[model samples]
Each structure stands twice: as structure tokens, then as C-alpha cells.
Target: MYSRISTVALLARALSDQAESYDYLLAGAGTAGLVIACRLSENPKVSVLVIESGPDVRNDGVVTSGNFSFTGANDRVLSYRAGKAVGGRSIVNGMVYIRGEQAQFDAFEKLGDSEWNWDSLFSYGKKGERFEGPDTAQKTAGVTANPADHGTNGSLTTWKSIGVNPVTDINGGNPHGFVSAPQTLDRDKIRRSSSAAAYYKPVDSRPNLKVIQGNMKRIIWANEKKNRAVASGFYAKEEKLGVKVKSAMPGVGENMQDHNAMVIGYGTANTLVGDTPFATLVTAQDALGNKMPVLAASSRSQISTWAQAASTYTGGAIDAKTYEKRFQIQHDLIFKQNVTIAELFPTNLGSAIVSQLWTTHPFSWSSVHLKSLVSFDDPVIDPNIFSLQFDIDMLVAVARKEQKAYSTPPLSTFVAPNQVLPTNATDEQWTAYVQANAGNTLHVVDTCAMLPLDLGGIVDSKLKVYGTSNMRVVDASVIPVELTGHTTGPLYAVAEKAADIINNDS
Candidate 1:
């Protein structure tokens, strides 16, 4: 009877009294969380409550200007302390907004649900986008953009807001080639376009939506009704309270995936000019003067190159045959259509031109789970980054390509050969370097993956939690596999679609 629940999100502090009941009580005001909240509350009759553990630092100068460290959760490959700010990672991220290959999304349908194909998600992707096409100065530096391929209207936007095979406009669904990344900045290239800025700011005035700055400590559980797996709720409480385990869904926090990345440097013939990382800086006199030309990212990428002969790692319910069907899409994208598999970009750090690269189609597997019975304790986020031999091989091939890039006419003119970098390095040296240095790109997904129940899936095509009557996960965690682009763009698409699903059900 509770299956038709809907939720909408905004980070407005609980202005007055907390309501005794709400149509939806969302545990997070995160990336997709707020998007779902906002969409669900579109119906004025539906009351939505968004709970945020972090403070609302929406316009805090310190938060906007730079980054701060938060202590919690360490990956097995390395330690990265990510904070839970009001806007989630969008506020403190690199602000690179990009879409993965079309085939990648289309493969989602094959993996489990027909409704999750790229064609449908492609629209949702553009739904929240407010794309700012490359300006004349940007175009002068080899930047290209398709105006039609971008959305002119949306809350999450440039200011607002791959691959081994080479294709133009990764947002067009086929990620390949060397191209400039799409930014999540505004028209002036100042201030990051977070979900708070794009989706919530305008709608914060809505009477039906409310946000509280605090953690959701527990959900008072109810007895099983209609003989359901886990009926009504799940909870967290003091040990003395002694909560009993209701049910166990083995796929709660398994099947984790993240892009393993490492930065390789090249000694430059000329001393680096700008403080920001990149090949060249395009500038105009903004309010802060021309000291810095607003930071932007440029990358050269290609397919994994080993696509034709790549192997898959199969376990759990996804047997060899099922895994083969899943991997065959990636193989065809690289070998058949020649889509870009890895992303390589240059950043001018210190005296060297550092090239940051990561493989997009990682088959390696890992898991993240709570360390103890406590709910709020940081989960053990152990991503076996180099779990696949294929990942290392891909990084080596990308390094080889970078060597060629450094040897090219213009770059060769000013860049010196690396004394201890991937430039001109041997395959053996590259492999060792990758194994020692590779870390996450922060493009993580699939922990609470959406797939078939027997296939280690925690959520369904509608994103409803497997055993729960009303609870659903509408974030990157529900994604079943890695894709060619950053998780941000696709996550927004996922939320957009999720909102519609919830609203329709309501």
C-alpha cells in the first residue's frame, strides 16, 4: 500500500516545526537525492523532507575558493577523505561535466532492465543541463561543441554545472578521440554550478519541501506485513536499544567500481606560466583582474587499445555467459566502432607538464560496507583499483600514446624528455608505475547496484530497494557498471528519470 510514495528535495533549513509525518522522508540531500526530492514535491499535496548531515555552506567563500579535508572512509588503493557537504561532491569536485558513450547506456538494458537504455537516459541527461558552448577564444585552442547536442535550459548546468576509440562530442553518446571536456561552470566561468545552485536555489521557496541539517539516526521498524522480505523500515540505534536484524539482502553494498587513475609528468623546455594545470590559458579581464583566466580542463583520449583481446572477471550470479554479454558491448565499442577507452589530459604542475589519465571501462570489482553494527560509522570503502590486469595494460598503452604526443612537433619543441616519467618509458616501467601509483578518479558507482535480484542487485529498474515497500535509491550507487564519462552527468540523468518514475507512481 505504501509503494506509491513520492519525494522532493531542497536544502532550506527546517524553518519552523518538524512535521510529524511526511509523504517521503529522504535520508540524504545529495546529488540525486535533492533532484529526486524536488521532482517528487512538484505535486503541492506531496510533502517531502530532505535530511542533510552537513551544514548548509551554499555560498561560503572558503568552501568555494578552495578545498578542505574531511576524515572518513579509505579506499584500499589509497586514502581520500571526502566530506559530506550540503551539496554533496558537486560543490567540491573538479566540475567536469561529461556524458559517456551511447552503447554504454544502451548496455544497461541488456544488463537487466529494458527501460534503462541510453536512448531514454540520453534525454534525461540533457533535461537538467544548461550547456554553455565554447567561446571564440576557447575554439581557438581546439575546443569544439555541438549546440544542438547541449541543453540551453536546465537547473544543473557550464557555470551551472573518455574512451579508447575516438569520437567527437562524448555527450552525443559515442565517447572517443582527443577533445575538450565540458565544464559545470557558469557563463562567466566563475562559481561551481552545484545541485544546490541549479536545482534547489530556485525552488527553495516551495512550501511543501523542507530540509533539516542533521543525520538520520534511525528509522523505527515495523513488523513484516503481507510476508514481505523487509517490510516498512531499517534502523540505527544505541546498542542498549538492541535492534534485531530483520532480513539480509546479500547485495547491499557489493559490486563497487571506480576509475583507477595516475598522473604522469613531462619536464617542460619552458617554465610553466600559469598556476592552473593545462597546455594554454585563455584569458579576459574579469572582476579579479587577468591574473588567472578561470580554470578549465583539456584532455586527449582514445580506446583501451586492448579491447579486442580483453578478458572479463566473473563471479556471483553473473556467470561467464552473462558477463560475456556485458563485456561484449565494451569490446565492440573499442574494436568495432573505435570509441575512446581512456582519458589523458595535461596539467601544468610545478616545472613539469603532468598528464592525468584513467581507464573508463574498468572490469575490476570491489565492495564497500559498514565496519561495525553502527550505522553512522564510516563504511570500509575498499576498491581493488588494479583488480584487473587489463586496467594496468590500458594505462601502459595510454602512456605510450602520451610518449608519442610529447614527441609531436609543437609539444616536442618545448617539452623535455622525462627523467622519471611515462614520457618515453618502457612497457615494464609503465606497468610498475601504474601498479604503485594508480588511485581513484572519484567516478565511483554500482555499490547498491540496480539489476536482477538473483544477479546481486540491490535495486530494481524502478530503483526501489529490493525488499522495501517504499524505499528507493536514486544515486550513483544504483548504477550497475562503469561508463565512459564522469558519473555526475549520468547521475543527474538517473535522478531525472527516477523523479518521473516516482511521480508517475504517485
Candidate 2:
């Protein structure tokens, strides 16, 4: 069931006999694109075509293996990483699956998106996952799950790692405490269960669907002068195969956003052991402990500063009032709601423990635009990490707390006596260290934000571009807000809901 059209000649021949126009044309065969294509192709009447930049790397070890390297900019300002294969970042990311907190989704509802609350979107979450029960060893280690919260039949497979403690369904209402979450792995639990494997492979045999390996040039617009623009098709370039195909769609590439992360690495004397890549996960309160109030106060005091910084970053695209409101929403999530602010990854490197500290969210904005019309030219991506003062301050605070965690109890007993990176440094020195060493977590979203057009929204709630008809952006770019967990879990849910919307449209 894996039909890969790697050559332009084969693709051209495949499309020559078919209708000139397809019922649906997807611009990227990555995470969101694959899900949308699979669901839309369910109906035999519809013809779906997906154009992807990368080739069919289904068996590429660099992509399929859990220990994969990054490919993107590593400049002083920001270090951005994105996958160049069919499954996108899913094939390269650390497979930790977290659905995020309920409060985060409720915040989306308050932001003029009534249909995006936790209750409404929870089903989509279940629809895309097939959860496996924890084994005897895992259950003995305190693993727990609620059967009602998991999906029995779904494309994606998930299971808890061995020797990890689990809480009552991490997908349920609360994810505040320590819990061992599931990962996107196959049944054998060796290879990664990427979107290409889960959603695309199962339905590749359908004659109605075609996946072409190529790069999308730009969205072709039907009417540019109209109040609401309409799309016809798009131009794609496949240089290796020497093909240039024009497919349909407008509002193709516009909005782009990425999660900005600061990694605080600590060298420990004792080797912290774990079968998987990550060992323990600490929430904001868990990491900060008694110092939680300091963060809350800091968040409150920086409301105006945040608003001004965001407004400036957007070039006044977001008004002062809207910026203020957005800051307030983020503040409430950080302070009142008590969402997950930091994630800790403990790894044993030979004789020392290298613990990675990541800030869950960093408030910064940037975009991705084509530098040239050529297919080989990479798109210009600017995440603008640490553009705001608040982001730096938040990351510094989290790093300080992570230092404290390494110094305490069971972990401290195992770790080395002396510090590694900022050894016995002052607060100012630690801040400088963070600025110099912090890197992104590779969870990018909200470029094509789902919101009202008045608020710099490129796509509607249905994942359809505002000014276009019959064209939708079903990628991580549509996510307007950052989630407490990884991007993949929520992205699957978003794509699932998007497919439902596209099908239900009259």
C-alpha cells in the first residue's frame, strides 16, 4: 500500500489521464497534509493530490530512528530545525506525546474561537491515537491509565515506556503532576510511527489519491483584486526529476510560527540511567517549587512590557488592546491556571549526567517566506528567539530553578558533587550563560494562525484560508497559541478536526 511517485515522468503520466482539476490538492505531504489527504480520500468520489518537497524517505535511518540530528540554521540569534522528509518533524522529533493542559484550549475559546475548547476538540485527539496498555513491569512501576480517555482503533500507536510511572490519563482534564506519558511508536516498539506511516501508508493504494515528490513554489491566485481572494492552483518544482507541475491552490504559504526554547544542560557526577531518551518530567511548580510565586509576580509586572514588545514585533499588525488582552491570557495560564512551564530530560553520558532543561513556551514571533521562486532555494525562516525581554527573563528563571533541582534529594545523590556549566556563577553570570547557550525545541506553529482575519489571522477555524475558497492549510502553522506539551499530539487532533470540517462543508 505504498505507491511512491518519485519521478516526474511517472507523476505526469499518472495525472495526464485524470481530470485537469482535482477535488482537493494538498501543498505539503508532511504531518498535517498526510492526515488531511488520508481523510479526504476516504470518499471514493473525491480526487486528492499531495505535493511534497522531500522524497519517500520511509526507511531513512536518519529520519526513522529516534536518535536523529537536526538540519537548519544554527546562527547566534536562533537555531531552527525542520525535517525535510515526507513525515516532516514527526520522523525526527523525540517521540514524547503530551496533549497539553485544558486551560490552554479554553484560552483559545476566549480568543474568539468558540469551537476550539477542550471538550469540543478532545474527540479529535482520541480519533487519531491508538493507545496500548502498559505492560506488567510498567504497571508495577506505578503506570496508570483511564480506558475511556484512549482510542481503541486509530492510525497512530502509543504506549508507555518501560520502568516509568504513569498518572490517570495524561490526556484527561489535569496534567499538573509527575507522570510517564506515552510515545508515538509502532507495535513492535522499535521504529518511529510517523504521520507518513500512520496516515499516508494505510491509504496509499487508493487511486483517488496521488503523492508527488516536489517543492511548492507559491499559491496561484484566481482573482487577486476581489475582497476575498480565490485560488486556482499552484506551481511546483522538482529539480532532480526535472519537472515543473502547476497544481491548484491559493493562500498556499503565508503564516509561520515556531516554539522558542532555551536548553539548560547540567553535568552530573553520577550517571542518571534511563532506557528511553527522557527520564523525568517536571511541571512549572515542580521545577520552581517554593519559588513559583516569584515567576507569577514577574509575569504580572511584565504585562505592559509584553504587550509593547509583541506589538512592535508584529509591526503594529496586532493593536495595543489586542496585545494587552493576549498577554493577559498568557499571564493567566502561567499564574492562575498553573500550566506546565518547563520539561526536564535526564541523560547519562558515560560518567556524567547531562540534563536538558527546556522552557515550555517563549513569547516571540517570526515568519517563513520564499527567498526565490527556485525549488532548491530554502525558505527564509526567522523565529526571532529572545526578541522580547520577558522571554529571556522567563528562561533564566527556569534555568535557575533547574540548577536548584540538580542540587536537591534523590537526583542530587546520583549526580556529581560539582556543577558543570555555570559552576558557582552569580545570577548575572547565569543569565549570560543562558543567552549564549539556549536553543529552540523544534516545535513550530501558528504561521497560518487560526483566528479572525482582523487579528492577523490567515486561516479560519475550519483551517481554510481567509480569502480563498476550496483551499485549506492543515498544518501546525494554523495553531495560534503554544501548547504546554509537544506539538505533534495537538497537531494530529487539529488535522483530524480539519478533515471533519472539510468533509462537512456544504
Candidate 3:
């Protein structure tokens, strides 16, 4: 229903309706924008205009795979909201569903305000949930609903994948084993449609709901005081076919941020060590039913067996060389309870795809800010990946730990048999390797945080922008604390509750 609004018509309408502003003007159509738009428009009386910087995601095969198969389908929009796309990044994520640790949110409370504390904020976490998993790991991992942990009925269709990767434990036996299972994706199809698809797509028919496609340039305020400045709207321009792309007028821009990642590649199959002090927070053991000794490394491991049933490329979009490089399989392992997960992309090609070590829950911080004078043009992104002190230290330690896991009996027998990761195996050797490799998990967050305004927080406890009267942020951006699970599930819950709050207030 929203796919019809064009740049020309949108501009014409805005010029004519400056005085009678939309009850709500949400900038960007990524995770947060979709939620705010869907929730606010539940009431037919209030007019809500959602400005997206990209195109719709209705028929994109790459976005639908909802798995690793299509993760790189679209270029990363580190610059602006997933350019005008209706679904935003939810259309491009690992699809793993997880909630932040209770202690984490409690820390937010300690660092800032009561409204952000675990006690008060837990409800919203649950409210946005649509639990369809068997809760296999729930009891084992101490993840259960206490009214604050989960929600039963939400608009998003959340569930465990009917199809699971070989690495994940489909049956709730050993809680520690790595299993690759599809999350937030339907097994019947490869695509991972987001809440925007399930929730907003169905209700765009409402007259009050108007989705306009344009590059959001800036966030214009009505007054001088930053907090008092009511967010009026944003500037937008159409992309030119070939001629000069028109410049948009300067105004307010949407402030976005995300976590940057550094992937560490190793030469051998070995277990990485977990964060020392951090180990106490977890409980680990060998795969259930297997007598194999459980290595205490710090990363999580998953065995993914899913491959694109059909060739991803029709002609030569991806040459055979590229396909071989991306599709090689290697053994996987998890260490240190489950802080990180490692995948071994095996290949007889060059060095033999040994083990690919990754630092889960990386501590790096970065952002997505506007590039031009307008917020609508793609935002400039640095993800300033690897900026945190703890981030580098963790990489060094994990590399050492993985080397140890490879030394174990059963795994060692299959691994280089003798040639393992960190071959020289010393603090120096591991450190050099760490410095050389390490990319992002692509799990970005916290561009517009939800907390009290006093603590440098943009959004309030209710997820509303602090200074605004009627606006709210209901996507991954509103998430103040980092989530232990992937961001999509939590985003769903956030949007669900946002809908309730707006509806109740209306």
C-alpha cells in the first residue's frame, strides 16, 4: 500500500501541508521507522507520515533468504537508513534471536535512570515477542519469562526454524553444542521477512498512514532549544537517472550509530579462550550424550548445513572462484560456555580452510551519520570498528584459547593433525594474527538510544525522542543496551509495545 508514494507527489504534498503537519513525522524506514509507523497508524484519526530513504523489499530474493546465503545481497547502508527499503536491516541480518542480559539493562539503570533499569524495562522486551521456539535452551540457559523476559502475542511472527543447521542441537539435549538454525525466517522459503512485512504491510490501507519515498536530509525542529525543538519533518530529493543528482535543502538529519566488528582469521583449528572474569557468567559442557571433553574456550560454535538449494547466480554474477571461496565448509566449535561461536570453512584449495575465529559480543563502537548537508543522502559510517580497548584485548586472548582447543585429542586428530592455529603458539604470534584479521558481526545497534534525556539519551524511557511530544523510536536504534541475542527479535518486541503505547495514548 505504501509502495505508491513517489518523490514528486511527496514533495508537492509537503509543500501544501506545512501548517497542518502530520501527527507524527518519522524519518527513515529501517527497523525503528517501520514500528513507529505501524503502531501510530493503528488509530485511523492520527495522520502519520513515514519518510523512507530507499525502496521497498517486497520481491528481493536476497533479502528473503533470511540466512547466511544472502547476507551480502545488498551493500551495507552504513551511510543512511537501508536506502528507502520498507523492511530496513531486518531484511539483512544474521536472524539470530536473543534478548540482552538482565544485568546489562540493570547497568543502564545504574549508569543513568530508573526508567531504564531492568525492573521497569523488562516488560517492553517481552511485549515485542512472539515466541515460537520450543524453549529448548530456555531452562538450560536460565532464559525464561518472568513477565519481563518474553511476550506471548505480538504482531511479528517469531519462531524457531523448522530447518536447522547441522551444528545446532535441534533436540534439547546438550545445551552447550553449536547448532545452526534459521531464526526469524520461515523454512518453507529462504527469505527473512521482518515485522515491517508482517505488521505494517497489512495495514498501510489506513488513510492516516502515508509512507513517502525520499532521501531524509535532516531533522528540522520548530524551536531554538534542542530539546524544545519539536521534530517537524525532514528534507528529501529524488535520485537522478543520469544527470546531476539534485542537492536537497539543509535541515535536520537522523542520527544513527552501530557496533563495528573485526573478524580474526586463524591458520589452524583450535579453541579460543574466553574472557577470564567473564567466564563466571556462563556454564558450559560437551555436546549432550557425547563423552567428548567440553573445551572451555570462549566462543560459540554452530554447524550450518543449509546451502542455497538453487545456484545463487544465474550467469556469472559470482564466478566459480567467488562461489568456492564463500561456500567452503569446515568443522565448528564453541568455547567458554557460549560467548563466541567459531565456524571452520574447510577447503582443500590453498591453505585448506582451517578455522575462522570470531569474537562474539565484540566491544567495538561506531556510527551511521549523515554524509551531506541533508540527512537524506546516505549517512557517513565509520563503525570505527575495533575502537574499544577491551575489543583488541579480547581478540588476542580468544586467538590463544582457540589454539588450545585445537590441541585437544578428538579435534586434534582431524585438524592439521599437527598444524593448528597460532602455529608458533605464543602471545606474540597470536597477537600478530589478531591484528591482521577481524571484521564486523554486522549486528549493529544504538544509533538513537531509549533512556532518560538527562543522560545523553535521545529517546526517553517510553522510547520517545526526549524533546518530542508525540514521536517515538521503535527499532534497533531505540535499544539502549546491547542484546545478547541478534537484534531482530528484540526489535519486534519493541515495535509491538510501541504500538500499544501509541494506541493506549490515543
Candidate 4:
């Protein structure tokens, strides 16, 4: 008891005397957080401190085993499906390395931030990667990669997957056709390489970097008037604390988006006897490894898409001109360039793998709102799934497309006659099926979007939150637009660019 008391007292005194401030103080030491923290502290003259929401959880099963042997997302590792660790989503997420469609980033530039486009971000994508091509034996097993499209050396490592054969180079500004994608994996270590493993650990010994665990209550703002709102520091309630500040922007938690699946199951003739059934599943080993999914992959190949002026089909009341300008880019990308818009995945069903078709760009939107700012409490997340008619119409088109492709000659032979969701069903039936079966890809993004302040945006081009100078949100939440496949690749690019922007600013 005496020893414990002494330790507590020492810790209190240490914190009270701790330098009182840092050059940079980040709230969450997650995926993007860690990346920025590492980059800023690189300057020996600067000091950085990170306050992580969860404990370090360095070697915990949730962080290490999720890649190799850990099977369930809601199983033993961590009960909740979200990343509740120091490394954030990178630790818990399946590390598939696929970037966003070129058009999506270009659309970001269209939304008034000319600095944020595919060309600039493409370089950062390569900057954060250390890709290793497949070996001769591995190539024979179906793994493939274009050496030019990948970075030879960087913080994160990616390599070929034996899941599918290649049709084209996916990372080279366009990802429309068939391609064997890469994963953020440490081939030498034979484990899933998370952001923590890739970007944080090597620089852990840096004297300028300090990491802590605590909840960020709010950004402490200066009461005095200024041109832009300036935050003096951040506040956290470790014990008894209280503070209230009303949010200035209504766009803070709105505009969240996620991918939805339109599945058509079947009972296929189990050929190869006991051969493991494979399909394009999102992340499963089975979200990439061995399970059913939210995101998908292939032994299967997915697609490209186009959108028309269909504002009447929208779910929420958004700006009409804003909606048209955005959809115009989607249409242009389809006719002018090669960009993946939807995906086709195969899922395991005890004895067979079902084909699932979903739109990469869904019109539906949702929010994750905070009810209180004074306490450390979980926010309410409202996922308005398939609330938009445009998404369902696209899924219907996708189902019809799936039916047409499979019912043809060579691909038709593999598709069994035991209709689970009946591909021959009418448009009405398809709509009903879409409404009843629509599910998440777990590819949620843009809650704290990176758009100009004039367009209902939460953050500016530099990734600094609007209305506040020092408070910035760097995470999957800051992605202005959602990508087509696994969201990890584009997220890294965002962090890398943010680091450069921060470095340039300071």
C-alpha cells in the first residue's frame, strides 16, 4: 500500500513538472495520428506528445494475431469491431493496400481544393510504401505485381497476393480492370504489418517523441478575439472535470459514408472435392483471410461505373448544385478514364461461395454524433443503410450486370443452377432484395471531411479543422470522399501528405 502510494505521488509530481507544453500535441495515436507524430518529431529541435485513447496494447492479440491466426472480428481479440488500441484502426483492420480511384481525388480538387488531387496524392501513396514483388514460386501460385507501380522502399511494406491472377496494374493512377492487389504485410516477419508496426516503432527511441494514454475532452480555445479561432491547448478529464463548448459547424459529424453489398447467393457443384472455396471477399483472411465479409476480394474480378443527374433519388436534403457537380465527375470518369466504381466479391457459405455485387460510390449518407463534450463517452452512430434510391438502382444495375455476365458462355458454366437470390428476378424483386440484404463493407469515411470551408466542410486542404487554427483531425474520418475497395491505401497517403503539410507549416 505504501509503495503504491509513493508511485502515484511520484507520477503526479512528474506530470505536474513535465515541460508544461510540446511543440506538437496530437489527441489520438492511431493510424494517421502516429504517422503525423513520427514525421513531426523527426526535427530534433521540435518536441511531440501523443495522447492515445486506449492503452498501448502493443503485443496484445488484437494488434498482433488479427493478421495470421485471429479469425473473428467480434471474437476474443476485442469484443467491439472497432479499433480500441493505441495503433487505432491499423492494428485491427485487415491490411489490404488498395488506393482510391483517380477520379475521386480529382473530384476533391473539383470541390475547390486544387492542392488535393490524384497527381499529388499518388506520389505520397508510393512514399509511404515499401513494396516487395512476389517470388518465382509465389508467382506460379498466382501472385503478381508491377514493380513500377509500387515503392521499393518506405515505412509500410506491401506484396502480391495469391488470391487472384492479374489483369492490369492497380496502383498506377487507374484501378478499373482485373488486378492482383497488394497487402501491407511484413513478408520477412510473416505477419500483418499495421501502421504502428510500420511507422511508429522504429522512431520510438526518439527523445522528442512522447506517447501517453488519455481521453481528449476538447480543444482548449483562446477566449480573446482573433482572425481565426486559435486553440491554446487541449483538455482531458482524467478524474473530475467539466467544460462545455457548442460546435460552430453543423457539418462536424454529418456526411459520413460507407459501402453496401447486393448479394446473390447460390449452391454450386463443389468441384476439386475438398478444395478451399474462394471468392472476392472484402478483408475476410478471410475480411481477406477465411471468413464472410463487410469488404470483399476475389478469385473474382470487380468493375467500373458511371453516374447521371439523379438528384431526386437522394436520401438526405443536400445542396442540389453540389450534388450535380459531384455526380458530373463520376460520369466523366466513366467515359474518359478507367476508374473502379463497384466491386464483385465471393463469400464462403459452409459449402459454397456466393457472389456479392455492391456500388463503390453509394449515395446514402450517415453520421456519428457526439451528444456531450464534457465527458468521455461513446458517441451515437447512425448508419442510414440504402436510404438512397440511386444506390439501390446501381445495385439493381449491378445485379443485372452480374446476371448477364454469369449467364453467358464460359463464366456461366461455373455458376450453378441452384438459385439462392434468383438472378433472373425483376427490377422490383431486385430492389426488395437490395433493401433487405444491404450490408456494410466497414469502409466508413468522411465524417470529418477534407473539403473547403465554403462547401459544408469540416477541414481545409491542409487537414486543419475549420474555425480552429491548431485543432486538426487526421484519420479515416478526414477522407473527403470514400474509395472503391479497402480504404487503407488512400488513408496512408492522406497521413503522409498531412505530415509534409505540417512540416511545411511549422
Q: What are the Cα lDDT values of the candidates?
A: 0.62, 0.65, 0.44, 0.61
Model 3 misplaced regions, further than 4 Å: 1-21, 69-84, 117-123, 126-130, 134-182, 218-227, 233-369, 374-378, 387-389, 406-420, 451-454, 466-468, 504-506
For candidate 1, lDDT tens digit of each residue in 1-506? 12333322222344333324567777778878778777878789888777777877788876565332211112334654454866787777766677777766776787777699888988898888988876786666556677767788810011111112223365776545555677677746466788877888778889988877765554544555555443332122234344455545666666677776767677887786632312111111110122212210000112232221222222343444444554555555444444456666566654787777666666566677776656555777767666556556666665565566666556666678766564556668777777777777777888788888766677889887766656677888888767765778888999999999888875
lDDT (tens digit, per residue) of candidate 4 on 19-97:
2456777778888888888888889988787877687776775467534211211111212256767788878775667
In candidate 3, what are the lDDT values of residues 314-363, reduced to their tens digit?
A: 12222333222212211121221232232211122233323433444443
Ranking by lDDT: 2, 1, 4, 3
Q: Compose the digit string of candidate 2's lDDT tens values, residues 1-506.
A: 01111112123423342324576777778887888889989999878788777788887776666553322123575546676778877877777778777888887778777699888888998997888867786666556678787787810011121112335667775665445567787635467889998998888999998888766654555554355555566556333343333332222333244544544344556554544333244455655567778867877787787767666666665665666776688778776777766665544554665556566666665666656545345777666666666666666666665566566555565565444454466767756666677767777777667777666676677766665555577777777778876899888888898888888883
Candidate 2: segments with Cα more than 4 A from true spot:
1-19, 68-77, 154-166, 223-227, 237-260, 264-298, 348-350, 373-377, 421-425
Which number leads on lDDT? Answer: 2
How does model 3 score by TM-score? 0.61
Put the candidates in TM-score order, highest first.
2, 1, 4, 3
Whichever of 2 and 3 has more TM-score, that candidate is: 2
Model 1 weakest lDDT span, ten residues long: 154-163
lDDT against true structure, model 2: 0.65
